[model samples]
Target: MTHIVDAAWQKILTTYGEPVPPDASPLLEPFAVLARVAHAEPLLRRLHPWTGMWELHFSRCTEMNYTWDLPYIGTLRDGRYYVEGPDRSSPRIAETDSAQAAVAMVVDRLPPGCGPAFLGNAGELAAYEKTRDQG
Candidate 1:
């Protein structure tokens, strides 16, 4: 069965166009690994519209579904993968020359109890969270 996160990512690909595959550019291998390994989480992946860098973020309940302001992964000019903190001005959380290492760092930092994305609007997600919390 297709996971909810995989379906969400398919929608993102159809909407924003596909990112170049890892085979096409070695720098993107970590992104590919992240997508594969984190297939069950509430994560969304995309390419930055302006920078064309691979980006990852938690799935949100907004119209876009992606929490764009969250921490994301990008490749440095020197061919290392780095996870930037929440905003552009925020410092890098981790940087590594190995794709596995970078992917691990991103996985380790996922938000607590993120689970599968709600796949709904903010109001619905809020309701779900409230119910989940109360149970």
Candidate 2:
């Protein structure tokens, strides 16, 4: 799953002709979470052509089966690159140069005052946001 991200990043660059400058690790955070969910959870119920962008079809979802398709960090036919976040209660679409910020967007999309996301801790989400803000 980790290795798949690099290839997806390459595709993002080729399609948009814009590689995320400096570093892509932060931008890839959401993708990492998607991979983790795929390995760790069994309730996720969706797949394919995430938000009509690059592969990494893994998408955002809740244990109850709610899901949202997203872009890992790529352009659509409209020529915009984004790492889209979940829209269960509301939607969040972010455009940024920092990979970490992209991760933060995903975290921010999480429902507030909730306990035990699929991973079972709010701090984990906070940690991702910390990385995003720090970057």
Candidate 3:
């Protein structure tokens, strides 16, 4: 069967140039934790930086339906994937066609309270890494 984590695994391989542990290729704990703590305030702020302040109200709808105030990022039509890390030097890619799914996947793999800072833009993500590398 095709696995959602395959693509994320491929990404990890390409980025790290190494193979992941068989059982540890995709971490699942963080995702579950994040799901439990899912809320819109922080996510909304991260997703929309230009707005001064915003309010989110859950409404019944299809495309943009949310239980919280965060914007719709995207859904994973083909399931989802994940990657976990203690790698402090990893580069964070801020944009993807399936950014929502991707973030969920990564969250699944991460440890609780280990959320990465969403830089709000591609340039910001890049700059974060560049600055980290320089130090």
Candidate 4:
């Protein structure tokens, strides 16, 4: 039987057009927690281009724009999980012994009034923003 979290992740993968890399297996539990909390939102799992660590991105939209408000979660060399805020130059938002705890931190820190993500590219998101603004 397929688990609900697995099913949800499958949907994200289908929409995201890329399979989770094998090295990301370590992050599955935390990813599942995030997937459960943001079930209605679209999610992206990718390897950070420079660091090559797996990261989970959360997107939210406004009347005129969309941004990944939640920090990405990744593992440190020492095995702790960390949440990095949008401003990479700043200190990490959180670090925890468990990836699930780190993900919980992310959920707790979601921006005020944040809703389900706009499921599209930047242009499509802009179009959506335009329509919403016009209404």
Q: What is the C-alpha lDDT of each candidate?
A: 0.54, 0.38, 0.30, 0.51
* RMSD values, in order shown: 5.9, 13.4, 17.8, 7.9
lDDT score at residue 36, model 4, on the 0-100 scale: 41
lDDT of 1 by residue, 45-121 (tens): 32221123566555444334334445666766566678886667888898888555665676576676544455655
TM-score of each: 0.56, 0.30, 0.22, 0.52
lDDT (Cα) of model 2: 0.38
Looking at model 1, the pairs that clash are none
Candidate topping TM-score = 1
List ranges where model 2 is wrong by over 4 Å: 1-52, 55-66, 69-81, 85-92, 113-135
Model 2 alpha-carbon miss at residue 59, Å: 4.1
Question: What is the number of residue pairs that collide in model 1?
Answer: 0
Which has the greatest lDDT?
1
Model 4 C-alpha RMSD to native? 7.9
Ranking by TM-score: 1, 4, 2, 3
Model with the higher lDDT, candidate 1 or 4: 1
Tens digit per residue, CA lDDT, model 4, 72-99: 6666555567788764565788777775
Of models 2 and 4, which has the larger TM-score? 4
Answer with 1 or 2, whichever has the higher TM-score: 1
Identify the superior model by TM-score, candidate 2 or candidate 3: 2
